[model samples]
Target: MSYKNILVTGGCGFIGSHFIHHLLKKYKDINLVNVDLLTYCGNPENVRDIADDSRYNFYKADIGDYNAMSSVLKKHQIDCIVNFAAESDNNKAVSSPVDFARTNALGTAVLLEAARQAGVKRFHHISTCEVFGQLPLKSKSKFSEKSPYNPRTPYNAAKASGDLIAKAYHHTFGLPVTISYCANNYGTHQFPEKVIPVFAIRAIQNDPLPVFKSSGNKREWIHVSDHCSAIDLVLEKGRAGETYNVGTGLEKTVTNIADDVLAILKKPKTLKKIVPDRPGHDSRYLLDSSKMKKLGWKPKIKWHEGLEETLNWYKNNPKWWQPLLSRSNSWK
Candidate 1:
């Protein structure tokens, strides 16, 4: 349960950074090695505060590169691996499906091989409920760990492949792997490409905040901190080859989310503009997190509370998300 040296892939990203912080704060004696390829969304500044700690080390490497992953594992003498590396943008995945496949599928395969060779004690993978595809509007249905995968987008398809690959390794090679499928995450340090930050920044600038006209489409949202905590609990008590779903039962349409962000910034409602929905956009994503709750992890932050706090974060820190606008604004 206690990992002496844990290698966290993609630790510079939003959710991964939060997980690293959680681990460092909870376990003082453990050392962490963060491996991030530093893609457009993966910013080192996200974890800059903890970069100087003696207990932390970082490497810039691709998870798909077997040699690089093996090197990092051996150098850090990692006993546990927590993987977050992926090309996660849905819109971008539509245009560049190959890129997503390489990272989500091939990258996972290579990482698992490296972990098996290193004989790591545990390998925990983070996943999305989108892999289960959409639910009907206003439906009570939710994605359980047992739900059949119905990925609608190239991104989710690739992620589904990665999850299957991980499971295969556990079944065939006896690799100790635990996977968690979570609802969408919102929190501080999230890339501007996401909904909350995009709305907040555009509202701050009095620019149009784009929203698809899918009034019935719903998405379950959970605070990044809550999701991170779920992963931590899994590492401690979860069984290998088992998958858990993490969510708060919180569902909201994008229109509602845009309105909330504007309200938080005291901006006018006119800032919200209806835009054409992207290709392969799922109509809904809901998750049944009772499995995770059974492990003593539950969502702590409410939707409005988390949204306001997240918008405030963007308002107070322009330097962090401003530079990202040009880097990944188009997501091409």
Candidate 2:
């Protein structure tokens, strides 16, 4: 499936920006349209290197605004829509459930309707593994495409609702839609509020790194580049209405991650501070990405090397992230 014009929502964000760069480099003739609300986490500087590319265009608009999204879709004659716009910060979601629902769920519905009306060829919804809730530490379970929805956080609940709405559009309106539930992603340009970036930045500054609870909670980690590759595969070959889990099948505990970051920076381990866990903190998250693997997609980056590279990125890119820390209180 060749796409001439692709509409990518939240393209200013971390993973979205990386995907946009990937798309541009891989397809010379592809014209890319980025629709971003420019929320707190959305930074245009993430893709500043490609800002002047002729094939790339950007529009500052909210996904939930039907008229706005419709205008962009019709104007671009977009054949594919990759919806990445959402309020994804879990802590912010806990305090701002209404905002999460409006963006993640309602916004997705609005995008689907616009895509359906505009006769878009493919609609890809990027989701997270938290929709399956947490797995027990000793459990051998892993979330798959068929995992039942059991969202425990406002963030995951909104995402799960968005995923269902996307599927519903496919089933009821015959809209071509594919959903991907990815594990935790870490890479350059990620906002500092996320676990990896937060710890890396703090360790670079020689500040205390906060570890939630006992830091035993575990999460599967996948590099952002690998995730971008998986999404490309899904968009090219994934069946409509089918869901795929994108992960590296690698798990790391929070303490382990913090320790690794500090060690990479040669910072003392004493900077590790055990903080109270967030409300409704999940114990573990594991994903069985065999379904996506069957599509000939596999993660290329090793966790250790990826972690070190990510830490070095934060250390070297203070100009890109330091200003963001002051703008938002969520960084703490």
lDDT of 2 by residue, 38-133 (tens): 998899898889989999999999999999999999998999999889998898887778999999999999999999999999999999999999
Candidate 1 lDDT by residue in tens digits, 1-332:
47899999999999999999999998999989999999989999989999899999999999999999999889888999999999998878977899999999999999999999999999998889988989888678777899999998999999999999999999999999999998999999988888777788889888998888775578889999998888989999999999999999988889888878888899899887888888877888888889888889878998888888888888899999777888875432
Candidates in order: C-alpha RMSD to true structure: 1.2, 0.9
TM-scores for all predictions? 0.98, 0.98
Q: Give the TM-score (vs. native) of candidate 1.
A: 0.98
Q: How many residue pairs clash in each candidate?
A: 0, 0
| Candidate 2 residue pairs that clash | none
What's the lDDT for all of these models? 0.90, 0.92
Looking at candidate 2, what is the lDDT of residue 102? 96
The local lDDT score (0 to 100) that residue 279 gets in candidate 1 is: 83
